[model samples]
Target: MSAFRARPPAIPTTLVDDAVTRIIRWDFEPGADTGVHTHGLGYVVVPMTDCHFLIEEGDSAREAFVAQGAAYRREAGATHNVVNAGSEPMSFIEIEYKQAL
Candidate 1:
């Protein structure tokens, strides 16, 4: 009786039950920052809103303009600091794989 039907599910990357996949939502006000940290596993990010990002690696830092609904992937073990450089609140969804040590 519905006008629209649901879509099928997408293929998963891993099959292990213990392999952790999580979605994290970040909200940053203007001039807010996330301190330097190292990622334990690979991650994919999708920005929910437009943002100006300042990513710092070691002593060097780069500025990027991230548009809404943009997807990006990153390698594991990467370290960086993130800063919000826009006038509005910046938000993004982060999906990271979990691995046991």
Candidate 2:
């Protein structure tokens, strides 16, 4: 956990969890956030709708714009907080690989 205290948790629903991978769907209303945390497994994210994000990493902050269906991957051990910066709701699917990819 980092020093960021941004609140109103984003909703995450596990879609699949197995020996090979773990999948989840995350939904966020405007201003909702995924609190600062570390990822133990490498994962890919596919945006379900166009997304506008405010990303906070330790002492830094940034913006991200991802189109719907655009998928991206991140390495394990990354720690950050993601906030829905757009006025509209947004959602994405997260697929975490159990085995290194």
Candidate 3:
């Protein structure tokens, strides 16, 4: 197991929720975290502010940097917790794409 500890869950604001997608704004104070979760649908992340992330999976942790306005996409089925490791607050928008049900 890793020594990584997650702080309080980051604040989430849902901006849009429709059949096609779910858009959410995640705001994190320095050291705030997104508790462990698994992604059920493909998604894209658009950084509103430059993000310094400390990502913790089952037994490992890593750091990532995403510049403001840089959007990235990912497939589903990933599980992890995210922490804001920078000194300042940061936020990002997540748009999850729904699959045919």
Candidate 4:
């Protein structure tokens, strides 16, 4: 198996008119994972490479094998832990929207 690799946030934070937008690109190798985190604002994920994702939700968890070019949306304030389970590196683009609370 290849060593796990992670990419840092591309755009930590940005001001867009009345709202703040954040963009990040991540690369995960097999058996790689991102520790638990919370999403304050809604987010959209666009996969650049195929990946098998394992998501932990509370006491339960779900797994999904997404193909390249797949797109997903997440609800605001959602929290979860993610893991990558695939032979090749998994890359994705994450876009977050932040508004005045």
Candidate 5:
């Protein structure tokens, strides 16, 4: 059983959904949140602008800062709610690798 509750739908704009990967663009306002959710597929995030993130998972939370153009990847099954912690708005590109069906 999972400890986290379902999160609200993330604000995302799908740019590409091909056989290989799903690419999405996300724009977040200050204090906005991307509700708690678990990743089903491994993914990569490319920052379009510098970002400050408050990530909450289960009973714990932490903050992260990534500069523009810096990219990071995460494996599947990561669960968390991502919040915009900075004063300004931020945007990023997310690419999720599709799993074999």
Candidate 6:
């Protein structure tokens, strides 16, 4: 378990969890956060709505803007806290690829 404490936890809803992939829907209210964590598997994120994010890793932080219908992919083992930096709620579909068994 992580030693760091998470603020408001982001809500995650599982849509699929099969042999090769795991899909989840994440909903974040303004100022909510996904906590500090690492991605164990490579993942893709499809934005369900336009999103403004504050991504923090260690002491560094950056802002991101993703438009609705835009998608992005990340490699495994990336660690950071994802926060909703905008005034409204934001959501995205996250698909994590599982290695073949």
- How would you encode candidate 6's per-residue C-alpha lDDT over 1-101 as one tens digit per residue? 56665456789999999998999999999888988889999999999999998999999999999999999999998899999999998999999988755
- Runs with alpha carbons beyond 4 Å of true place in candidate 3: 1-6, 99-101
Q: Name the regions of candidate 2 deviating beyond 4 angstroms.
A: 1-6
Cα lDDT tens digits for candidate 1, 25-79: 7777777766667988788888889979988799899999989988999998889
RMSD of each: 14.0, 2.6, 3.0, 6.2, 4.3, 2.8
Candidate 6 wrong stretches, greater than 4 Å: 1-7
Question: What lDDT does candidate 3 reach at residue 12?
Answer: 98
Say what the RMSD of model 3 is. Answer: 3.0
Scored by lDDT, model 3 comes in at 0.93
What's the residue-level lDDT of 4 in candidate 3? 66
Poorest lDDT segment (10 consecutive residues) of candidate 5 = 1-10
For residues 1-101, could you state the per-residue lDDT of candidate 3 as single tens digits? Answer: 68566476699999999998899999999999988999999899999999999999989999999999999999999999989999999999999988555
lDDT of 5 at 75: 91
CA-lDDT, candidates in order:
0.74, 0.92, 0.93, 0.72, 0.86, 0.91
Residue range with the least summed lDDT across 10 consecutive positions in model 6? 1-10
Model 4 C-alpha lDDT per residue in residues 1-49, reported as the tens digit of each score: 4554463222222323245667777777676777667988888888888
Q: Candidate 3: count the clashes.
A: 0
In lDDT terms, how accurate is model 1?
0.74
> Per-residue alpha-carbon lDDT of model 5 for 1-101, expressed as tens digits?
68553433347899999998899998888887787789999999999989898899999999999999999998999999898888888899999988654
Best by TM-score: 3
| TM-score of decoy 1 | 0.75
Ranking by TM-score: 3, 2, 6, 5, 1, 4
**Residue 68's lDDT in candidate 6:** 93
* Model 2 score (lDDT): 0.92
Cα displacement (angstroms), candidate 5, residue 48, comes to 0.5
- List candidate 5 stretches off by more than 4 Å: 1-10, 99-101
Worst 10 residues of 3 by lDDT: 1-10
Alpha carbon RMSD to native, model 4: 6.2
